[model samples]
Target: MTQTPVSKAPVFGAPPRPASDVSAAVGLAGLAGLMVWVAICRAWPEIGAALNLPGPRERLAGSSAAVLALVFSGTPMVLWSLLVDKVHLRPSTGIDWSAPRPLRAVTDGAMTKLAGLWATWGLIAFVYCLARWYWRGPYVFAMDLLEQAAPLLFLGAIPYVLWLDRVLVEPRDGAWHFGAMLIGREAYDREQVWHHLRAWSVKGFFCAFMISILPGGFGAVVEADWSRLGADPVAWSNAAISAMFMIDVQIAMVGYLLTMKPLDAQIRTANPFLAGWVAALICYPPFVLMGGGGVLDYHQNTAEWTYWLAGHPALLWLWGGIMVVLTGIYAWATVAFGLRFSNLTWRGVVTNGPYAWTRHPAYLSKNLFWWLATLPFLVTTHSLVDAVRNTVILGIVSGVYFWRAKTEERHLLAADPKYRAYHAWMGENGPVTRRLAALENALVGRRRGAGEGVVREGGAGEESGQGDRHPAQ
Candidate 1:
């Protein structure tokens, strides 16, 4: 019998599969800088304490700390980019530098590098300013929101900016190659990689923020005693629902981070419509913070029938169940998207899970939940005009979501051929689409029956005329 040949294992130091070296090196450098900064802060308690103190002295100390952080972070990246460009990058081969790259390119790369280093300190300064003013000002409660949100945003922005900067400027001449081997496919074009990185970096920040806030919810749930549950079921139910919402948020964050396998490069989105963008912006922060002048605020739409029904146990359960189901569906859509889930850009064509049923399952379910929760139809109003106005506003919000769905499809169809195929399949196979087709068919059949009767009557008249002309014939 012939002996089976054993395959040789890859050598330990073999250039890392020639994946996106630039991305890898940049990432490593960023981490190194952060580690160094953290170590310095740990070793020197005076610097940390000075930075945290209140007022002008603290601000000056923070600025000095930020400069040090930049120095610590920026050095590794500059050196690595230099080493790779000079040593690893060759004239004849892999990435596209025919001649030696100028020193200017490397210096330009440092701008974003500096920006990333300063992101955390910048956030800290902003929060301090906001807290100092807002806490002492009329909106005293805003301070509480600040404390809960600031740390999440600050910590998240550090990595977000680091990746963001790496993508912002493409130094093809540098030792780091622009092309990245993603999802085990061909090397991604520099542009594609840039877009993918930008989208994810921003998306990651949002996900991180969501993940960070989860601990507050966990703490609340943990501290809650079950013995107190029966005393006020509505409050307990609300608390439980809130807890589940946080869990859904955590699932989404993890799914976004993990599902980027096989290179996560499935679909890329086309440019979205301006109206859709505007509508989406109004629903989120900064714009939402602007108060009534902002496009539309969900808080303005007070709850109606559902909140009232909370007093009754059976109705309350039904309402709570519906909300929970809707939340689960939203989360399910995110999970279905896996690593492809991002707003504004197309990541890939996701056709499984809730997507198989309807094209915009998350948006559909979410809007439905909102409508149910708000029940604009049953909302109390001072006047009939007010009632109509409230209903119209709610309708506009629904219309915005509908337009968002249409625009997303348009983007996906143009960008991903797979999405185009999926769109066709969904039209034919989706549950909602099938139901709409059946309804249309019924309407057409009834119209055809009515038309046939009219035709028969007209035919009799024509035959009588012909018989009159031909007598007995």
Candidate 2:
């Protein structure tokens, strides 16, 4: 009897991260950071008034600020969950669309997104406030920060809570049996549900979002132009930059929310997303840590933001064009390689999708999207230079990709002979690689048939109307 084999390439490009999953953890941490910033700023004046702030009180204040940050960043979910159960919401498998029973129901997810959004936007306002405070223009304490960010904080709540909860709520059993209406509940098969969970994983979103943050973060690094903050022209400019940053973050989040899923959640052998995230976590933090807002020393300012954004439009044109044209091609290739290969015991050589065009479509797209998304935040002349740098990095990463791809192919080939054949066919079709082949070809060209005396045919040395073989005409 013959055994039937399964191919996993049926779903290559994962679903976008649902808004809920992507934002929840990050928003929680961000909220904590912002709240701490707010509390410190708010309390500074009063604390200073009570005691000489330059003395022990200042140190105490800083310590308190750090502590507040830690708490706000870490524990809000625990509190929310504790109270959530106290409110007696059922362990649902679907959405409850009929007015969350009480405002508190709406408040949970809504407040979280709103708070997170506000905190981020508020950080933008803080730039101006910091500037004003430095210039001695009366933007003194934390209240100033709140006042500046208040509108955003309030308005932001609308999108965050409404959208995220909808994504997260599971119907008690795949059908929210509400009063005359079925809410975010639909029948779900285990396979589809698992697919969804995998699709919405953090790795899908983090790759793009992290890449772009440097520019925005850099914009936040400038010492507040205190005088300009209180003034009209600069104040508005600052606000605009803040708004832009907010838009970018959300854009990145949404992109992840909607596309790029993983194979599973357990970070085990079966999951592709965990691997993607693990790869991203390794590559991303170091670059970002050395970049704009992640640094302890300074954040990105308008100039920095302007500078970074300059590179994006061109990159978007180049890579976006490639992806658009290649994605369909990628689909065919993903399926073909997946099936013909007949097995996947290989190492991390992802030869599906656009990988057929080039060995490292994932690497290329990752950098392309990262730089493209980052361009809006920092519109600068250095965009090309930065691209060049990224290209260099790609060269290095390609080495790893090569090793991984090779290992994976070997594994597949070992498991199934058809995979080995397909691999060779692809190699024969000319994988336009940029590495050793070029130099080797060049070296070969300089020596091989250097002075061939072959007869010319057709237009070069023969009659214009003639075919190469006289009788063939």
Candidate 3:
């Protein structure tokens, strides 16, 4: 009797609805606002003098000014999301604005939530104090900024929490649960407390780094001599790349700072797995293992694309263009997140823009850019050993990123059914993901076939009494 073949259809439901939490127009609006502000800052020296403003004739390139740019960059997104997308009314916000509870009724829960939030901030501050890296180099700016904002944040939380609790469908959220655990006044879910800590940890860790690096790139782009770049391919490409980085950093910092439930941008869950944290933290400073002289440093004795392709004008132009495009894709990945971008957290499932083509476009483009731009295999020292070592080390670095992507998938797949559907859809339909899956399947088939052939040959030898065996047997 013949048996019927099982169906190979995906178990994951229909592809997630095309709707995304944040719209493309919302991000584009923020981009427009940021560009307008950047232009004004670049021309501020002249404009301030023209208006007889009380300041020196210099562009606003200070760290404080860059922080202000975060405001400019974020405000338009908030406005667009509210005015256009009406995200505040979304059911995901867990808000029922139609019938706000009496202030007295929610006052207790609000206080508990605030307690959890403040304690979390205090703990993060303690960690910052203990970490020596927070007080040195670029982190000094972050420290300074936080010091100034700490009081404001404490003062602001009271009203925000109180107001939010009145409309919250479930006021005893993760923060409230954490507060309950701390106060020992009410029953609380340990998992909720754990999730609360993880979310804040992601925000605290990434936000500081984002703020510390913000002013440098913003200043570079604001102070760039655009007139001189037109004739120099290297300068032109670098300028473009710098601008892209500025966009990414500025917009991403805003996302980290503004995870308000009212905006429908609250972190759903921080990546819960320890492996996820390990994979992510090692790529950032103070824990980065890929820095110069570090264990995973892959840039030792390497010559960059510009150096190797120096005399070839056409090739230099082509290579530079490729790098710039890759950098743009990386930036686009961040911008596509709108107000939902952050590391090791799920704000929402974004399925539009570059994300539609591939789930990990940013990681893919980033690793590719490093390979093409650094040319790690082509060492300046001209030693075969150095070349081989650099290439292998870089491969390991890429593997770390692959690890990160997988861990993120594990977290998201567990947290959201939408992500599961999107994952399955991408595996079956995404241009990049489908091709890569096919290649992987093909390789696995070849290996299995090769192993089976070897087993058959061994069996034949044993049957013919030619197989290796002990003489005693």
Which candidate number has the best lDDT?
3
| CA lDDT of each prediction against the hidden true structure | 0.45, 0.33, 0.80
Per-residue lDDT tens digits for candidate 2, residues 1-473, read 64323222223452221111111233333344444554554456567768765644322233234224334433443343234322123222233445444445645434433443444444445554554332232223333333554677467647644653553443121111221121233333554334333332332224223323423332342223445644343243444444334323322222222211111111111123333234333344334332454432122222432243335655434444444333323222222221111111221122333443343343343433333333323323446554454444434443333343433332333333333333333333324332223433366563322222122332111111100000000
Q: Which wins on TM-score, candidate 2 or candidate 3?
A: 3
Q: Per-residue CA lDDT of candidate 1, range 165-283, in tens? A: 34332433111222222222333356544554444444433443443444444344434455777656466566666645544443343334332212332223324456545645555
- Residue ranges of candidate 1 with Cα displaced over 4 Å: 1-201, 204-218, 221-233, 255-276, 289-293, 298-307, 380-382, 436-473
lDDT of 3 at 107: 92
Q: How does model 3 fare in lDDT?
A: 0.80
Put down candidate 3 lDDT per residue, 179-257, tens digits, no spaces.
Answer: 9999999999999999899999999999999989999999999999999988789989999999999999998898999
Question: What TM-score does structure 2 among the candidates reach?
Answer: 0.27
In terms of TM-score, which candidate is stronger, 1 or 3? Answer: 3
lDDT of 3 at 412: 67
Cα lDDT for residue 82, candidate 1:
52
Sorted by lDDT, highest first, which candidate order results?
3, 1, 2
Q: At residue 188, what lDDT does model 2 achieve?
A: 32
Candidate order (TM-score) = 3, 1, 2
